[model samples]
Target: YKETLSGPTRLISIDGADHTFGSIPWQEELFSNTLEFILANLS
Candidate 1:
């Protein structure tokens, strides 16, 4: 994601088989994965 972006716009790319979607549903995993990645670098 780019910080210079404004408004409600968003973008991302996902690797379907990387995390075993068979176990984690893609819909719920969408923001979960992004949230974790973003928070990891917050500090």
Candidate 2:
């Protein structure tokens, strides 16, 4: 599924993270990765 993307793409999986990111550390990881992706892609 991820292979068909047209532009920049990122795949992240947080260890011990559930679907809802129901913990602080997991949520932080998610947010940090998201921000990194966004910053890297910005023109």
The backbone clash count of each candidate, in order, is: 0, 0
Question: Whole-model lDDT, candidate 2?
Answer: 0.50
Model 2 agreement with the true structure over 1-43: per-residue lDDT tens digits: 3242223342344332344455557556756677677778895
Minimum summed lDDT over a 10-residue window in model 2 is located at 2-11
Q: What TM-score, over all chains together, does every model reach?
A: 0.37, 0.44
Task: Show model 1 residue runs off by greater than 4 Å.
Answer: 1-24
lDDT of 1 by residue, 1-43 (tens): 3441222232233353435444658644665666566667676
lDDT of 1 at 29: 67
